[model samples]
Target: MTVKTAEDRLHDVAIIGGGVVGCAMFRACVLAGARTVLLEKGGDLLEGASKANSAILHTGFDATPDTLEVTCMQRGYALYRDICENMNLSVMKTGAMVAAWSADDIACFPAIMDKAARNGVPVKQLDAQQARLREPALSKDVRGAVLVEEEHLIDPWSAPLAYARQAVENGGTHLCRARVESGVREGNVWRLDVAGKPAVRARVVINCAGNHGDLVEAIARPSPFTITPRKGQFVVFDKTASDLFRTIILPVPTALTKGVVVTRTVFGNVLVGPTAEPQTEREFPTVEHDALEKLREAAFRIIPALRDHDVTTAYAGLRPATQFSDYQIEALPTDGWITVGGIRSTGLTGALGIAEHVVGLYRAHFADPSPLANVVVPSMPNLVEERPRPWMQPERGPIVCHCERVTEHEIEAALTDRVLPAGTLGGLRRRTRCMMGRCQGFYCTRRVMELAQSHLPGLVSPTGKGRSDV
Candidate 1:
């Protein structure tokens, strides 16, 4: 609960953007015993592309071999496993099936397996019959599949919060509604001009702004690379349809894309679609009517039975992609500045690895060569067990959302949690399951909004009073 003064001007490192990468970097800095400041323009954390992703934990099974991305993903998967276990976060290792429907796709499987092996990912090829037995929902035309036992599904919302919470507990400052307008290096320190706030002086600044990475880099004039926002749209199927698949079913990759896939979320809901299309950074993800139809057609082709399942929601997320296929993490000549770009789709799975890499860069390039002391930061209690949903904790059993089985108590906790503050009802619904049901907040919006307003007063009116309805 310690808040730094606007004019205080103190921090070892300042991270712009509060997305998964930025939050992860903040956590890494904290763990490395560096005083860090995490700045976000959104009212709460994970409000950007991070919260709306497909939430699949990639295993680098198809990533280009011997690349920085592949290396990071492999290390990240192990790190995530440790963090998930320690924090009691929701993550399901349901495995993954990369199925081939045609001769060309089948031919590509061996190459993919080779690539995975080079990336140090364990994968085994399965015959068509074996694939069908593993995932009966798959189409009969399937030629074969590569079973990646390590790839998993995670609750995207919880993962970043876990990192942010751990960072805050470790004395890192997480400031929301604080946007960095521009920054520059003056002597040994980097001074940041935060929107509507006083300037902050820090020894180093890490650019982890996701879509706005280029803009942040532009603030200092020249940058190594530019970022382009690649949009991916997805459809969420009802939890009742969860039985359609036991593992994440993926389509063989083409030269341009990874194709569409079906997967079961940790919340027991089935997910489909994730059509990647190039788009503007200002444009938030939304399902195009054509995209939705294309997704349905592709999904039906993979699992004909999926055509019968009810789709609960459709959304999109923007991926910060660069011209390079591999990740770009390097220090700038202008003292105390680093850029983390080209995260692409593997970002979620590779976040921790990226953080660790950035920390090493700080030690090697930015910080002095003096040996740093290891500081032990206390971790937050696991909320997954203590505040389970009504269905999970039957004593509090009246379901508010029949489709998702979200409850009132869960909504209350989401609105009140310190680390992942739910400023709006939609935000609360994202954090908890309160209003993300088939009704789509029709039944619970009012109550959830009321609770959110009560818990986060200023947040309910992010634009002051004029746009109170937001």
Candidate 2:
């Protein structure tokens, strides 16, 4: 596909950032029969925090009762469940358990249960024996746990891709590397000066820039809230260790943190850690050696068997923490803009609900409701054909990564996806797990880079310059 220029005319809505929240907002705008444009600073969609998340479909159990975040999470969970069923995306309904390790921790269960009930999440308190019966891998010292049956794991890669795919299918335009330098509101519309390109006009602008939310808000001048980057690092264990727990094991939350967790990813890997630490926006937010050690210690305390599992990978993600505890979703009626800020850790679970809410805000403020005709929900392409994975398809039968069983077909499909730019081996690895095996790209990095260079344009091949290093 050839690269296209930005549109000069005004759109119904222009969403800044191509992360999950932005993608969801774009889809919702399109579904409401509004012309929408999504601006992404990165080379492709999901290049930000959206792609590097814990990938849990939260049950609103941890959210404060009856708050906007909690309500949105619950609604978004249902919406995502429907979308997953319709799109054929990988979704695992593995329940989550909030384990207590001490008497004080055990005493907190009632309040947690009350919060869950207030949030409309069905949770049952289980004693250590019962908890062990449910998940035998849990440490015997577990005092008790609250079972959140509705909680599940989702494929992090597919969620944003599906949203972007559907948005494009619904005639929404997505522009990559089109960073919004600044914006000025003139009359009823906002004109955005996009990175050396022609200014694009829109009736409404929605800021869903994740970590860059504050930056984008500054461009609009006089921000309502500032965004802080809260970093969390995690480790992925080999799929052979997926049996470490039948359910997601979570530690009781403190005022500051949700603590460490051991959960099964939708991709079939067992994951642990995600220590929350505050960091500057300029930093890339990565795993610290000390943090990893602490995570391992906590993981072993929760489930001793995890210590025996071989780690496949380790990475970090930055959450866009804001001043407010609840979501800072508001419309700048005076500025003809809307800001979805302070999403934090629960953004993934609340994405769709937030999108829907943003759409209503547009209608209420702009007073222009287009015909809802031709409402279309795009079908997602099937990425996983079957289980025991290798024997599912001819391509899967050939192992590209000895540890992950990632196939050539999967990598090829991810590379060819128009919305994703798998130009580098690292990008491909993020998209398809091509080099995210136990060896951590030690064995297949060269081959993967070669394939990426051949498949993606403007990427440097291993043999050197094909396109300008510029």
Candidate 3:
């Protein structure tokens, strides 16, 4: 069978990014009976700002009321819960608490409660004693907290991957390493000039180009926003530290960010993170020593027991922030373009809802699309620790990665996935959790390289020699 690449065929909708929002947009457009093609500049999906996140599914409890961000978040939250089970995804129901550490934070409680009520998210106030009763691991400095019962944790990688898979399985095209360099509108169609590939023609172009949103948007019209990349650093604690807390510990919100959060990931590791700092680089977010140290200290402050545990790793991610606070989603019918930019931390939770909104825009301005009959929904492999791992199953192959318990079969499947195969080492790690463990692939690198020799190119061997692509 011949694999499909981005051809000269005129697609109905063309998405410019492969982040969570772009993946979700592809899914929605395909389901709505539109011929869609997603162009990702990276080797695989989620290579942009969507790559690293806290992975918390927000409830919009403290979101700015009556804003597009909150509206999309609530709708996306519902849509995710609705489709998770069908897609074989998991959600760890570790609710969150906005712990007040100071008198100023406590003073913000009334406004927080009012905002939650206005946003229609149910949240109850908990006194310091009551908060401590619920979470015995909290520090003595905790004054009060607002219990957000619906906030939860999810696999940040798997959800978007599932969306992309579902779209591909339902007849949508995904072209990786296909960067949109320039575009021009010809009558009713837009011809996008992709780097090294043939120009792709589409009737509608949605700019979901996360970090490069401004540059991409300028191709259609004068960009209404400027993308100032905000770097967020995080520290991951060992899985043993996960036992110290059952709830997501959040700090009071400020004008800049939601503040630092200490939460347990679905993979059974305690995560402390996300120091927001502004930067100009669109890619390559590096973790600084000072930021990591501060995050570690903050984690220790929140859960004193974390100091006893080991630090697994430290990483950083960038978010596409703009001068405005709310999301920038608008339809420019004159140019046959739509801009979905300035989606910062809430993009994960707001993806599906934003997709829905974009579809509405497409229908109103572009063309009337009939919903597809019997759409396909792909079932992703179970990655959440609560679910049964592949290594624990019958007929499981040899365990290649002992720390993450990734089996040889799992790696093979990820490498050869029919819809969206892992194109790079980072993609493979996200798909199988193979190199994201205690050892971080120290022991399994050679075997993984051997398995990927035929599929991936330019991979250096464990002995510092490059393997010829099969």
Candidate 4:
């Protein structure tokens, strides 16, 4: 397939950033029957904060009432329920809890309930005995918990991919590895200059550039906030530890962080930590030794059984924290651009809401709007953790990646994934769960690489088989 140059296409909308928010906006724009083109600086989708999240689908329980964050969360949660059903996305409806150990923490529940009420999130206050009965592994020191029954868990990798895939199938374009260096408004249109590709001309440009939103906005218009990368580290325990908690076990909020959380993932693994440390380096997300000790101590108090479980992996991600508490979204009518910045965390939970909000901004400026004649939802490859494996099928081919129960047939589908611009091993792992299990590719590294080499031509095989790189 020959890729078209920017000159060959004048998109109705060009969206910068291919993270969850950007993908969401792309899908929304396409659904509105616009010619949308998504440009990502990264090699693949969900490579930033979107990938390394805690996968908690927050229900706006703690957000400030009437704020854009809470409103988006309230709306996004409903949109997610529908999208998950139609697209067959894996969503584990395990409710969330804010566990309180200290007296001060317990005192905060009333205010938490007040906030939940304002946001329309139905929450209940639980006593110590009820909390303990619900999650037996919790510390005896725990006084009570605030439960948000609609809160849930999902696989971190798929929602954006699903949206982007649906967008592509609906006539949107995905321009991977295309970083917008600068953009300018020519008359009524915006000319976005990419790093290597031809300059893309669009009627309007939507900036959803995550951490680089500051830079993208500075290119054409004034940005409201400066993005600072706050590094967070986490530990993933194997599925053997999943039984410890039926819900997302969260600690009371602190001044700096949301506090450590111990939650079971949709993939059946138990996730803990996510110690927030504001840092300068966005690229280097190394888990600090002291941070790990702090997280371990927090875990020991939150769940004593954490000591018995073995850690499958430990990694880090940087949040695009900004000076503002609420999200900064503005319609740059003068520049034919829209800036979406300061969406630090919960981008996954509020992605579609943000998209709808941005599209409204775009429509206010771009006249003669076109609506889709028919809507189509694309079906993604089966990546649900609880679902049956391809190997379970009669006479299926060889089995690979035993730790994840991935079969050769599933891997072949990933190698030829129709949605991806480049069928990378990392993408394959996200799509088919090939090398992301407990061993961390220790056992299936060579075989997966060999399979990729045999299937995908000229694809450079990854070394060490680690999550990030060689």
Best by lDDT: 3
lDDT score for residue 162 of model 1: 75
What's each prediction's TM-score?
A: 0.92, 0.93, 0.98, 0.94
Q: lDDT of each model, Cα atoms only?
A: 0.77, 0.79, 0.92, 0.82
**TM-score winner:** 3
lDDT of 3 by residue, 33-117 (tens): 9999999998889988998999999999988999999999999999999999999988889899999999999999999999999
lDDT tens per residue, model 2, 1-470:
95545568678789999888888888888878888899988777777777677888998887898688988888888899888877767777889999988999999999999988877779999999999999998888999999999888877766777787787877888887688998888888889999857888898899999888888888676777777788889988887887677799998998877888888776678789788887786337767788888877887888888888877778998888877788988887888888888888888889999998888898888756674666556555443423345435555545567656677666777788765446445456656766666788788766666667767667766677787331
Candidate 3 CA-lDDT value = 0.92
User: Over the stretch 106-171, how does candidate 1's per-residue lDDT look in tens digits?
Assistant: 888878888888877899999999999998888999999999998878877778777887888767
Model 3 weakest 10-residue run by lDDT: 461-470
How many clashes in each candidate? 0, 0, 0, 0
Worst-scoring 10-residue span by lDDT in model 1: 377-386
Write out the backbone clash pairs for model 2.
Answer: none
Question: Which residue pairs show collisions in model 3?
Answer: none
Report model 3's TM-score to 2 decimal places: 0.98
Alpha-carbon error at 203 in model 3, in Å? 0.7
What TM-score does model 2 achieve against the real structure?
0.93
- Please provide, for model 4 over 150-264, each residue's C-alpha lDDT reduced to its tens digit, 9 standing for 90 to 100: 8888777778888998898888898877889987788887888998888888988888888788888898756768888888899888888888778898888876778898888
